[model samples]
Target: MNYVILAGGSGTRLWPISRNSKPKQLSQLVGDLSMIEETYHRLGKNQSVFISTNSQFAPLIKKLLPDIPAENYIIEPDKRDTGPAMAFVAAWMSLKHPNNPMILLPSDHHIRDKRTFMEVIEAAENLINSRQVLINIGIQPTFPNTSLGYLEVGEEISKEAGVHVYEFKRQKEKPDYKTAKKFLDQGNFFWNVGSFAWTPNKFIEAYKKFAPVIGDHLNELIHDLESGGDGSEAFSRMEKVSIDYAVIEKIDPRQVLTIRGDFGWADLGSWDQLFDQLADKADAEGNLVKANWHGVDTRNTLIYGPADKIITTLGVSDLVIVDSDDALLVTPMSRAKDVKKIVELLSYKKLQQHL
Candidate 1:
């Protein structure tokens, strides 16, 4: 199957490390290689792969993803969410390979169990060949996660896919803690991983049905690009929305199917999530350090600084200290998820360079 990566998040929660100029996908937040590189390698083999990102990221991605042809990069001129972003991708792919099944992935997710992940992806890809359903790869929820979206499943489709295929009942994005507990109790909800598989034509049809305005806008821009005109202005005019809101949620329930993702997955959206993902790599005091550091009486704290700079903490507990060249962050681990607000405050203060 062909692949298209939605590489357009600003990654505000990551703050100084992930900024508007360089998103999280382009940063080496987890391992030696950047997140995007890891995602490319993890795909194993595919006919072709494309990355759709904002214009600021185009040149960087070009230099970074050398194996992918420069033409494969789709640059959104303005910041629109996944609704227009993905519609644009589907439109472009339909022009090139209408019948080919395509898999869409978010570039910034962390997957520890790639074996099970690929198995689920293969099953979803296979389902699209025989069925024209809009596929959503839903991870079985490990906990009551309030920050992420949830998917409710209905009837089973088949057990042959190495997973139980299910009818997608509905989608609920970012439910409250109480509702999340109820979902877990019902035992039918899954975390919406934002990965999907569908033939290009089927996706186009769904866009036409549920999100026609976005489809038209992207089609116009694609036509402009084909005729040697830059679609910068056209793209800037497209509506800013997400696929979940515009298309996925509105689709006929009977036409949607979900494959169970039993693999280890985390968006790593917040510092706490990152901490959990790297727990095994932490020190005895439950501190994860990615810098030159000397500490005393520090417990359950994280310290990240420039590789060459020594960051020392004394008598601090449950605090996160991240030292960049221009900015230093100190916050309680309990509020790690609120780092995105710091980015917003920076913008409000006209701290453009830091953002």
Candidate 2:
């Protein structure tokens, strides 16, 4: 199976540290390795791999993955969401590795237990017989998180899917707090981790059958590429939507399957999530610190800054303080979701430099 990673994200929730120039996936926030590098290394060195990113961070991707051939860099001219991007992958792969099953991974996610992660993907690969099915790698939820959507799982069909591969019941899209808690209590929900595996021809066929708008755009792109016409420009005008919203949720229930990923997975989209996932990075007082900080009676807080700057906290608890070279973000731990709003406010104020 060939692996492709989606590396486009408008860094918003994790601002200050993540900007338009560099999103969290490209940042070395968790370890010595940047998130993308970590993701590549987690997959074995023997597999064929590709990265799908927009024009902005293509240089950094090139610099990081020098061994990857120039042709493998699937750089789109502009940012369209995952729907168009996945369609692009299928269209490109049909021209290149036509028969290969493609495993799509999110460019930025903290996945502990790489062996278990691969075990899940490999299991998904084994079961992928046609385009009628795309196996979603679902992480068993550890908490009632309202920020993420849930996958309701049904019947298991294979030995590999002891409980891993199951009929996908329905999507519980970012449910209310009460509903989230109810899902957690129900014990059948898995967090939609955005990792999927399926063959290109089949996936593209499924797209044409389900999402005609995206399918038409994919057809146009393929036609343009073959004719040596302006394919990228045509792709740029395609509707912006996510693969999940456009196709996955809309597909016949039999078209989607779920495989259990045993790894500890978390999409570090918000400060609080970042703090929670890297629990080892925190002190006993529940404070996760990266920057120069002198704390006085601080507990359950995260303080981080760029280089050579000291951020001091006084008698504060449950807060996130980050100092980027151009911006400073300070918010309560509970309001981690509001960071995206702050990014919006910056855009509204025409503070382009800060973003």
Candidate 3:
């Protein structure tokens, strides 16, 4: 089996600390090792791992994972979404390891326990090998997280599927409070964690059924590979789309399965998320601190970054304060989701240096 780490996100939500040059995947948000390093370490032994990242970040990936072969770095010349990204990898892997199962993963996610993660991946791999089914490792829903999409299971055929294969139900964007609560109460839904596994043939079939554009491109790529040609030029012809929209939602209901992942998983997509997941938290005064803080009445706030900065917060609650040598970010926790908007505003204002 091959593990494909999809590490192309710019991490717009984690700006300043996570910049254009150094996105969240390459940052040590949770610990000393960067998220990518953690991901590489967590991957079990005796498996080939590939990283699909933007061409711009290739050098950093090399520095981080020096042992990873140059051929394993599938650098994208342009920013295509997940669907095209998957197509490219699928084609590449199909040519090299045609029958091998491929696991798709996002590089920046935080998983607290590696043991349970390994168990889940092994189970998923077994199912993939046995049935040749397209699988998604679903996170057991802990909350009515409107931020994530929910996967509803259908029936239980094998004991492995406590519930049946996952049904590609309607995809819901962030829902209002009431709707989210309803999903939580329903008890059958799991958060679409986005980790996937499938044989190369299954991937091509799904892409042809759902995303014809990518399917055609993959076919052309295959033809080019057969003619002893490089795929770069052919890959450029495709339109970028996400795997969720291009394949998962459109596939036949019974074809895809969702394996429950018991590992401690966190998306770490926003400032508040990172704050809540921090290993340490300060007192009742609401002064939440990590690695850097020296002050009084720094109430109900989150602060992280260099210790030398001497970040002193006075009378601040529900605020996110992140400091770095090159940039500083100060924003209310309530508006954390709008951090990407700030990135956009900065871009429009021609502040590339800060990005």
Tens digits of per-residue lDDT for model 1, 23-130: 889988887878888888888744388888877787887787788887787776667788877777776777788888889999898888888878777787788887
Candidate 3 overall Cα lDDT vs. reference?
0.78
Q: Tell me the spans in candidate 1 whose CA falls farther than 4 Å from its real position.
A: 45-47, 233-237
Worst 10 residues of 3 by lDDT: 161-170
Location of the lowest summed lDDT over 10 successive residues in candidate 1: 229-238
Instruction: Tell me the TM-score of each prediction against the true structure.
Output: 0.95, 0.93, 0.91
Give lDDT for model 1.
Answer: 0.82
Q: What's the best-to-worst order under TM-score? A: 1, 2, 3
lDDT of each: 0.82, 0.81, 0.78
- Candidate that scores best on lDDT: 1
lDDT per residue for candidate 3 within 1-355, as digits (tens), equals 7888888878788887798889999988877889998999999533498988877898998899887888887766577788887887787778777788889888999998897777777777778889777888777777778788777775445545332344444445557778878878887677887888998777887887778878877888778756866667777887778888888878876677777676889898888888776635556675667656777656668788796768776666789888888878899989887888988999999999999
lDDT of 2 by residue, 84-162 (tens): 8888888887777776778988889888888888877777777775434778877788888887778999877665844
Model 2: lDDT equals: 0.81
